[model samples]
Target: MSTAPHLEAGGLLLIADESLSPALVEQAAPVLAQGGLALCQGPGSPSGPRRLVLFDGKLTPTHAEALRGEPPALLLATRASDGRPSTWEARLLGDLLRGAPLLPAGASRHRLQSVADISAAGGAAARAVTQAGGSRTAAALVADVVHELAANAMWDAPVDSRGQHRYAHRRSEVREVAPEDACELAYAVEEGRMWLEVVDRFGGLRPGPFARALGGWG
Candidate 1:
């Protein structure tokens, strides 16, 4: 059970956590191979840098908090309720595999200065996704997603010159986002999908907590 990532120049690797079902992994691997990257397969062991662990059980934010950006990123796969793989994010994953980010460079960008801006962004996102033939249930989640991400950018992301938290202590204030300290949101709609990206100039997002809280978003 050496669950280290298959780090031998393979582009994308599919591996499973010991707790993840073999059937789920078997069903998902080839289905996601079309991204056209140099994908590979192997049973990566647990605990290491740059590990993409798949599992079937519920995981907590603490799990994500533990990683703390040592690997800088991760992706986890789980079984769908219908006993198949969940491909809801396949489009985004495909885009990532293709080496494009910010969810496509042409995504529309929005500036966030207040809660109203967050709501507007979410509403527009949901509309674009639903109108593109995406699932309404999925579209409904846009608000929650955008809200949390935007809140992070406005509150948790900002720091003073000494890297001390600036707005983190004033969330109750819901302080107006200064022009130079605003969160930037970008999104794009496709035939049956859409991507949302939030960016803050601070560039100090913590991966672990983000992973924990956002794990079940998609």
Candidate 2:
């Protein structure tokens, strides 16, 4: 089996249900086009590495189930609305379109092994942001996000032989992350975009649970 071609700067496949309102489609088209992304309707599978953007008013269990078996790269879901993409979504799409690294070129990389390391990495990222003329508030926000990502990567990531999360039920206490379980934190700012990435070696995130959690689908 051959892999699909990656979505490039002008190649996006927007899938919508047949019952989706024309008003919503009108609202979404300009946003995608302005971002240099091509748009199409329905569920036709395109060849190559194309990113899949599903605009279905809101992501539901059905949508989540449809995407469950696929690899979770460059897949985005958005509500059908008149507004443009949110900042986070825009950045995500930008990275996908350009095939950019999660952390941009010249990023500062850190190997984090504990809560303290996560904190230090966040601080370093914030400092880098401020030094590059970004506002203090922006820097602080970036730091906070970095801290959260690190926490998730460290505490919520590890799985044992039985597919159980090692620290899933642990209380909020200081725990030392083992060297082998360390996460890589990287951040960089380029061309008015700040890129940050926290990588845990174990790719344990599942789409269904994540979607249900976010959408309150339970």
Candidate 3:
């Protein structure tokens, strides 16, 4: 079993957006409650003061109207460009939690070997932070962001082609895999910036908008 880094406590406050499925909402509720994080619950109407507001898909006019009264401490909206399951929802949540405040994703760090290892790579990275005594405030953010972008490269990149699969994660850099199906991933911390790079020899495919969006989270 993998041991995640130690997680600091600020408490996660999850505001379920209207777009979230009942199942996901249910799952998050217990997790936050267990962690002692406050869960914001009220009428769906957006009118009111709130720390943060999360929505399932694009905020509809009604949703927006409700929010007009409450500017939300932060706004998170999900959208599916590739029609992948929960990918968009995950992206929105990651973005709001990270407070990235930027558009257009970052550049690639390295080429990855086989798409199968994206989850493993991300999981490893998140585990490293948690085990290293990082903040759980963004633990899920780091994990999901890395998992989605890295996983996208594996499934979307050409089976024979190889391009650098790079990503920026919490206070670390990662570079993994190149020639062999089993490449290396590197993570380092510098000047309070985390870097993650993945190197793969196969070079020829381009990432799609959906994958690109996920990568741009930072």
Candidate 4:
């Protein structure tokens, strides 16, 4: 009997980071698709974990379905103020995906109140994956998604005085570690799955652009 050739699994990679321009995201789609991967502009992705890249958005039922199984290596990047990818970030994501163990059974859910808490919650979620013996790629994905959501919320959410402006200018301290001052949110971890939710009183008042973006990620 002959063994079957290893086939690259197909899955979805949702982009939620509003900071990332549609053009940049559209450009990466081809590369990812070539490897049997795809990019979604909303929260819902396929049921199997091919490669879901969440930028800054909510998780829809479709997105949850796509994340059910073990995911492929994750590629995360740190961007500059000008919205360009940083060399260090690119290398870091590449290295992690190339070499990271897999923690097969852990699911986490998070709910944030303010944008300030996004990074912290994400970092915590990633560390959870590491502690659970899962691949760092999965952990990185969770962190990156949280980071993206936080960024969008801070910039887009409705504010009392400034109309949803947390950081007028990019601050090194906030960017490096968002949870420290990002706000107190809710999160949970169990089994091998993770869900993060960002809630605000103003959510009902007006849905921002990120909400629409999340829908497309799926």
Candidate models: Cα lDDT each: 0.65, 0.64, 0.43, 0.46
Off by over 4 Å in 3: 1-116, 160-184, 205-218
User: Candidate 4, residue 133: CA error in Å?
Assistant: 3.0
Hey, what RMSD does candidate 3 come out at? 16.0
Worst 10 residues of 3 by lDDT: 1-10
Candidate 1 lDDT over 93-211, as tens digits, reads 66664566737557888899887898899888888887778788888887689889998898888888899987888898865767777888898975455777898888886565567
Candidates 1 and 4 compared by TM-score, better number = 1
Which candidate's TM-score is highest?
1
Candidate 3 C-alpha error for residue 26, in Å: 53
Q: Give the residue spans of candidate 2 off by over 4 A.
A: 1-13, 17-51, 54-100, 214-218
Task: Output the better candidate (1/2) by TM-score.
Answer: 1
User: What is candidate 2's lDDT per residue for 157-207, written digit by digit as tens?
Assistant: 987889887775782864776688888998888766578888898998766
Candidate 4, after superposition: displacement of residue 29 in Å?
A: 34
Candidate 4 residue lDDT tens string, 1-218: 01111122234343434434545555444444443343344334334554434332334433333333354323234244534344434433444344532222233445454444565677887887777777889889878876776555543443445454444344343433233223323344555555454544445233333345544673
Enumerate residue pairs that collide in model 1: 2-45, 3-44, 3-45, 3-46, 4-45
Which TM-score value belongs to model 1?
0.68
